[model samples]
Target: MPLEKIKVIAFDADDTLWVNETFFRKAEEEFCALLEEYLPKEEANKLLFDVEMQNLPLYGYGIKPFTLSLIEAAIKISNGNMTIDLVQRLIEKGKAMLQEPIELIDGIDETLRRLSEKYRLVMATKGDLLDQERKLINSGLENYFHHIEIVSDKTEKQYKKLVKHLDITENEFLMVGNSLKSDILPVLNIGAHAFHIPFHTTWAHEMIDDKIDHPNFRSFAKASELLQIL
Candidate 1:
């Protein structure tokens, strides 16, 4: 199906607009190294991932929750023998991640600029609201989006609600993001068009092994290629 009917173009913020998963990957490496004395690097990584999955319900997603998970994992891995200095290093790592400069993906600014001219551009991202807002402001690309949504989660229900809130029919909305699980499947399931732009690094939680075939689903190697489809 052509995108002629798409009136609103929603973009995912993290890996789609700028660098995100890379920072998380780096943090995880640092965390693993910190706990290497207690457990093997591979084991430390597995334990941290488990802790993160468990804390998702209570802490949700973002650097802060991830930091907490790291601390928790450290304590558990070390049998409550974690040193104060190590805990402080973990905290500092999270802070550094939060303060990392917003690095826009190559051609993101130009792509968003071109799309904003023809469609009602909006940012649809899931994370801490304040952090999302801060990144948007610092990015200097916020003006391109007519509206922004920092959602708790991206489910079919959330997508449906968003369309209703935007007063647009499902067919009139198009979502673009890097994750097949969060950004593509949910939007397509809701009867909206979706474009998947794969980032170099992805969180394991967002990985999907099965193939997805739908008239409204498309994939691109990079965000700049969106211009060709739109």
Candidate 2:
């Protein structure tokens, strides 16, 4: 049976709605290549990613402070050569991240517009509060969503909270995201429906080492095509 009976449709804001992770991955690569002479490729990226992983507890998720982590790694390894030039470059990159608004995935808005008329639309995104809010406010789709939840993590806790607030059952709602670990599994664990759309660029931290081949999880190739499954 298709997920046609779902009354509430919740969407993941990051890669599901638009392009994300790719910019950061490119930044990380460029940043690492700059230091690749001093550090092994694996060692360089691992160090940068480690610094970022630790900063998550303090800064949460966003491109602003993630750029800072890269700067920190560069400075720490610069051997007293950390100049104003490097810092200035990092600052420019961070500003670019902040100013460049949402890049919607193909057919995302059109599909959402169609779905909004039939089902309750909610933004189920997880990231830094201010950054996520800025993206939403600029995306021009803010008016379409009835509610938005930005959290540190996308566990069952957040999903349960949404169900409680909306007065809906787990079975009546559908969770859609690019991340299987954070977005698809937990909701499916609770018996809610899920749609998984793999991203073109995936962050190392957000990746799942294991693959999923399950009955309840529906994987779609394009955003517009999601309407068919629904």
Candidate 3:
């Protein structure tokens, strides 16, 4: 259960390695304000969340899906009276999100630099494959990882497959990320160690209320703290 056995240290992309959810939040605010005439700001925001949840299967996760959901929510709220120009504006919002700068979290570079020297670093992230790749390239951290996995989703099955691909046992893997749902629970469930490095902002869909009490589970306030644990 200690760091002594961790051979491969995997990290989640989005909010873990760089700024992600904050851009989504800003887009959501802009979207709600854009549709304020059709519905109240709060109502518009709630409807967007509903549409996003419903479309998760069809569109999966990323800016493209989010943009489509925003459009669908706008049309439904406006009773099919949403203007083409407004829809165009929404599309532009998604483009802006995709184009946003990849700001690495504070201390991420140093932590990754130090950890890569001691452990085999892997980048395990989920999003549109192209978008994820673009962000990785822009982040300038691609060289830090020995293996890069851009998965569609994160689950016990996915993590198991990752371990198999890495030629490592579950006990030798350690996952660190901001999302409990995608990063922590799945890895821990698969008998691997997990660390929760929570970001200030998270997506509504990724929220969880239960506390993780497993022996292999640990929490840190920031990436720098991992140095002490490692």
Candidate 4:
């Protein structure tokens, strides 16, 4: 599990590479405010999250799915009395979110540029394929990645498959990202090195209470600090 053995370094997109969850948070706030007449903001937020979890299996993740969840939650909150105009507003919100300017995480560009020189860098993330690809291209960091792996979800099986696809053994793979649930745990479970660079805010679904203690696990506060070790 030594860093010396790592030949491929896979990075999680979204908050790890650029600003992502922040937009989602803002959207959720706006969603709750939009439904305040039907439900309290707190209750509306909770209901929206529940709706999202329930829809995950069917819709997966992305702005489109989230937009759908917002509309569905609005219907339920209003007991199916929500206005069509409100629905249209929610759709517009999602479209606006999809078009939000890409904000790169501090120092990620330089970090990735430097890492690419010595490692086979891959952008391994889970979400809507088109949206993720679009973000990558717009972030202007696409050239640093040797491969892009966009899965529906990040799991141990997917990480194993990724390692296999890269023609590397598990120990030769290292994953760096911001979420413990999606990025760290699964990679470590697959016997690969996993490093955590936590974002300021994470979606509730991706949050975990477990304090990770593993030979292959390490956590850092920022992207630039990664250079100190790897």
The candidate maximizing lDDT is 4
Number of backbone-clashing residue pairs for each candidate, in the order shown: 0, 0, 0, 0
**Against the hidden reference, what TM-scores do the models get?**
0.99, 0.92, 0.98, 0.99
Candidate achieving higher TM-score, 2 or 3: 3
Tens-place lDDT digits, model 2, residues 162-218? 888889888888988899888898898887888898898788777877777666788
Q: List, residue by residue over 111-227, the lDDT tens digit for candidate 1.
A: 999999999999999999989999999999999999999988899999999999899999999999999999999999889999998999889999999999999998998888999
Off by over 4 Å in 3: none
CA lDDT of 66 in candidate 2?
89
User: For model 3, which pairs clash?
Assistant: none
Instruction: List candidate 4 segments past 4 Å from native.
Output: none
Q: List the residue pairs that clash in candidate 1.
A: none
> Is 3 or 4 the stronger prediction by lDDT?
4
The alpha-carbon lDDT assigned to residue 21 of candidate 2 equals 82
Q: List model 3 lDDT by residue over 34-70, tens digit each.
A: 8888899999999989999999988889999999998
Query: For candidate 1, which ten residues in a row score worst on lDDT?
Result: 221-230
Q: List model 4 lDDT by residue over 158-216, tens digit each.
A: 99999999999999999999999999998888899999999999999999998999999
The true-versus-predicted C-alpha distance at residue 24 of model 4, in Å, is 0.7
Q: How do the candidates rank by lDDT, highest first?
A: 4, 1, 3, 2
